[model samples]
Target: MTVAERKDISNYLNRPYNIIIKSISDESGDYYVARVLEFNGCVATGETREEAYQAIYEVLEGFIEDMLEDGEAIPEPISDDEYSGNLRVRMPKSLHRDLSQAAKLEGVSLNQYLINKLSK
Candidate 1:
């Protein structure tokens, strides 16, 4: 889509909906997934990036219509950093134990070892 078209759509959606788009890869790196996150109470996904974005817009429109019918209040749009914070991911017990052992062998804490590895 052209930049102008995207801006137009964004303006239309700014008042009533919150949308986020993400590009992700499968574990095998053979396929791409486009994920739409936190669209009020609904989430949508598609194989292609553009398809995912379009699906979210269509779904949001329907959701808004239903809310209007039910006389429910629409939520305000969220700011870019509204949900930003420290994030943590879980590791398997075996992997965690291995990492801890490696860190001990290196004479460093697990967090420091991981940080150093990641930084490199």
Candidate 2:
């Protein structure tokens, strides 16, 4: 179907997707940077988080629209039904006990401690 016949732009745009926002400040001033993770070079910046978010969203919409108009392919947003962000791992009981003890010593949940350790 043609872009116009597919669905409303706003409706099509409203979905869960990864957007990475960062704060950039220096001696000059503060700036908020935002970008859709899967949008390649599409990005926007503003003075505040809200402003940056709106700017990035608009940029994302425009990017998608332009891609559609040009007959270019656009990746779909993250589907809400997928990616539950939960996982199960099996390890020796001794390892589990050691991790729990370490977590207690660190004063953090096992999950949090593991995440911090793994991320480093």
Candidate 3:
């Protein structure tokens, strides 16, 4: 690969892509699995959380490399700033009416009531 290509991959690796690590236990015993959310099928596992994280980082490196070589578009990380914190959800009219009545009984706005319920 060209130096330019290497640099491009390096830039992507430096980005703060979201990584989720979860503990799992099976007949094999307890371990941790890590994956990058942006890269589908990019996953790795290890006996420890730190090891799992390191393994996932290494996996991401190769994953990005292969994607670049294949001329696939790389997905950038989405920062929290991109979100407005306003979610628009569609619910059945009956449910909406029920929620409104409940919120009214609780002496709170429907928005606040929903927020409180969701926070739980």
Candidate 4:
């Protein structure tokens, strides 16, 4: 890779991409898996949680490098300001009617009822 490409990867690596770590228990033993939310299919696994966290960065570097080499646009981590807190969903009419009735019974608007449900 060129110097400029390497530098670009370094800059993105420093960005605050969300890293999610989940623990799994299987017949072999317990292990931890880490994935970068911003980079689909970028994942790492290790015996310990800390190891999984560290491994994710290595995987992220590789993902960024590969994306750069392929001339694919690298996705930047989304900032808080980017979300407008509005989501439109399509559901079956029956489900919608049920939800509306439940919301009415609870003395809340459908939006507020959905928010309360999602928060839990």
Please provide, for model 3 over 1-120, each residue's C-alpha lDDT reduced to its tens digit, 9 standing for 90 to 100. 899988988899999999999999999899999999999999999999999999998999999999888889999897889899999999999999999999999999999999999999
Report the Cα lDDT for residue 103, model 4: 100
The 0-to-1 C-alpha lDDT of every candidate, in the order given, reads 0.66, 0.84, 0.95, 0.94
Minimum summed lDDT over a 10-residue window in model 3 is located at 1-10
- What TM-score would every model get versus the actual structure? 0.44, 0.60, 0.89, 0.84
Clashing pairs in 4: none
Give the number of the best model, judged by lDDT.
3
lDDT of 1 at 95: 95
Mind giving the per-residue lDDT tens digits that candidate 1 earns over 19-55? 5666767775532333224344555666776777777
What C-alpha lDDT does candidate 1 achieve relative to the native structure?
0.66
Candidate 4's C-alpha runs over 4 A off are 1-4
**Rank by lDDT, descending?**
3, 4, 2, 1
**Model 3 lDDT, residue 17, Cα:** 99
Tens-digit lDDT track of model 2 for 1-120: 565634755664786657889999889699999998778998999999999999988998888788877988777775657778687999999999999999999999999999899899
Ranking by TM-score: 3, 4, 2, 1
Residue 64 shift from truth in candidate 4, angstroms: 1.6
- Which 10-residue window of candidate 2 scores lowest in summed lDDT? 3-12
Question: What's the number of clashes in each of the models?
Answer: 0, 0, 0, 0
Using lDDT as the measure, name the better of candidate 3 and candidate 4. Answer: 3
Write one digit per residue (lDDT tens) for candidate 4, span 34-118: 9998888999999999999999999999988888889999997978889999999999999999999999999999999999999
